[model samples]
Target: MSTTLVQIQVEEKRFRAHQVIDRLALDIRAGEIVSLVGPSGCGKSTLLRIVAGLETDYAGRVLIKGAKPQLHSPEVGFIFQEPRLLPWLSVADNVGFEAGRGGGKHPRVGELLAEVGLAAFADAWPKQLSGGMAQRAAIARGLFTQPALLLLDEPFSAVDAFTRMRLQDLLLSIAAHHGTTLLLVTHDVDEAVYLSDRVVVMNSGPGRIAGDVVVPLPRPRDRRDPALGRARSEVLTLLNGAQQDYHDIAPDIAAAPPAAAPIDWSKLSFAV
Candidate 1:
């Protein structure tokens, strides 16, 4: 890994009476997909916002490609839980918004829409599209600027299971196709294990990373694979413990050996 494409080093971050992040330090390499998992109010979203240069009121340093991040960085794109599309804007127009970013040449709107399977819906209104289609359009918009980093905050959480799976595959394909580094914040352990190259588990209340586990499983991975199960178990173990006790289990669970027996993939159930 090169000298990290994104570096988040924060001593403290607060919102009035609530403290969000505490002594957080992480270096994300180029083209890597990393997930951040933790309990609610762990500052996961806040950290992501800082990385996108959207929240600068915190006490910390976020360096993108060795330089301070800025608003509309063109190097970073964000996709929130909801599609948050401008309902009135046509799909093409929403995607075309990326063009106004400092006169940068980007992948064409038609091509981007096509990549997300929205080729024919270019002129369609957001209300005319289904939930999945709208989210896909949001994805296309995110990729419009050809960002080096894509910040996703449970982008697939609102969709159905099947749709979420498809979107997960879409995300992986997009990352592989564009060589874009991804930093995702997800509550679904399986989803994190399924998509990430590495999973960094954090503890809540003044968020601090407890463990960083590498998912050694191969790409285009099988959901039935026991390796993913083991990885998910490790993350769950980390999350199941008290925030302070996370330090104790992070290494042990991560160091556990891979499961040898392949369980029926359908038999095991995980988050919605």
Candidate 2:
């Protein structure tokens, strides 16, 4: 049997007398892409943060490769919701920051820049690049360490629809090419279905895993594919059911329009 890349066992936590994540258990195998979908404040991001070792004040055991999580370890990479790049640093410098001075720059930094189609802006400062470009740089930086696990917290949520689609494709390609295990937290059901091998639905506040469904879609998925639509609907149903009590606070899943038309891939350029 194959070994698991990461595992969370009975992970529980509370903040200010309120439970955040309770009894959350999950296991991700090597090379798998698992997306966590839930309403806002469902502790999806918090759970991810805990797994990434960004937050240690929590209950339960988080095991990475059968050992405790090490946030600063080079084996894990985290991509936050915002690009969070240094305005003073150039693109290459930002991506290679973690390598430290003379840490033997990441051999894949240039390749990653090309993969995200940011080669032309290698010397550009963060403030000079477009929203998409900055986020791409953030992704490149996260991958510079060649982490075994990549944790993304709505990394593309801040971009335009077109840019979001392009970044999604780029992320999928990069993950597959690197054989990196991924745990993504996103509110967009369609986005989760488009990029994930498995969709793990979480219940609102005092969050816990509600459902674990395999996507079963073919690789190189098109956003408008009928299979993707079905998967989105399934996830929507799960989320809808999970939102019963907090109806007024959650997004209107019932009123959401069907998946938008197929994404335009031609506009998305990548060199790697």
Candidate 3:
């Protein structure tokens, strides 16, 4: 049996007087790839931050391998939406930034850059690299610590569609090679369904788990597979239902979600 790598029991998480998350419990097994999906301001990012120990103001307990999470712990790596690499630092330096500026000289720096296909740009400045390249560097940096769990918040949303697909594939490959557990927050349903072992749908208005869809499909999933399409439909249904529920209860806070069209399995995509 797989060991649980993360255990979260958040009774309440708030911003000032505004509650953002309430009574949420989740467990992620080692080496699992899980994605949190929901509408904007559903506390997805906040939940990720709490897991990373970046937000301790919340009311909850989060455990990483049965231990309390520490701030900036090497066991936890976080990749933000943007690369956030220092403009003055070289690619190698940025990837090894956790070790300080001299990190560029670290041997693992070279290996990570190579793994992310950025070895040639090791000495390149952040400005010299494109958006996708910068994100690639960020991925390398996130893995520099050889973290057991990696958290990403909309990491690929900044890139173009083609680049996003490539990065997704790269992430899958890296996770397989490194056995790193991933917890991701993404608004894109297709991305969540494709990349996750489980899609955890969150409802807004004090975010709570609305549904959990397990993708039993094997690795190397086909993007066009009808099974994936069905999984995506399930997620969309859950999302819409959650939204509608929120809208009914808090009409002033959230607008109702648009009705989703039925899925056409033969097309392997949502029906228009």
Steric clashes per prediction: 0, 0, 0
Over 70-108, each residue of candidate 2 has an lDDT whose tens digit, in order, gives 768888999998999988778888998887763224667
Question: In candidate 3, what are the lDDT values of residues 1-272, reduced to their tens digit?
Answer: 99999999999999998899989999999999999999898899999999999898877799999998899799999999999999988899999888985898999999999999999998899999999999999999999999999999999999999999999999999999999999999999999999999999999887999989999999899999999999999999999988987888699767547689997778786559
- Residue pairs in steric clash, candidate 2? none
Shift of residue 169 alpha carbon in model 3, Å:
0.3
- The reply for model 1, stretches above 4 Å from the true place, is 100-107, 242-272
Top lDDT model: 3
Which 10-residue span in candidate 2 carries the lowest summed lDDT?
245-254
Arrange candidates by TM-score, descending: 3, 2, 1
Candidate lDDT (C-alpha), each:
0.86, 0.86, 0.94
Native RMSD of candidate 3 (Å): 8.4
Q: Please provide, for model 1 over 1-272, each residue's C-alpha lDDT reduced to its tens digit, 9 standing for 90 to 100.
A: 35589988998998998877889999999998999999777789989999988898888798999999899988999998889888767888888776764212244888888889998998788999889988998898898889999999989999999999998999899999999999999989899999998999989655888787799877889998999999999888778763545435355643458678987899989989
Answer with 1 or 2, whichever has the higher TM-score.
2
| Model 1: lDDT of residue 210 | 79
Q: TM-score: which is higher, 1 or 3?
A: 3
Model 2, residue 223: distance off in Å is: 2.0
lDDT of 2: 0.86
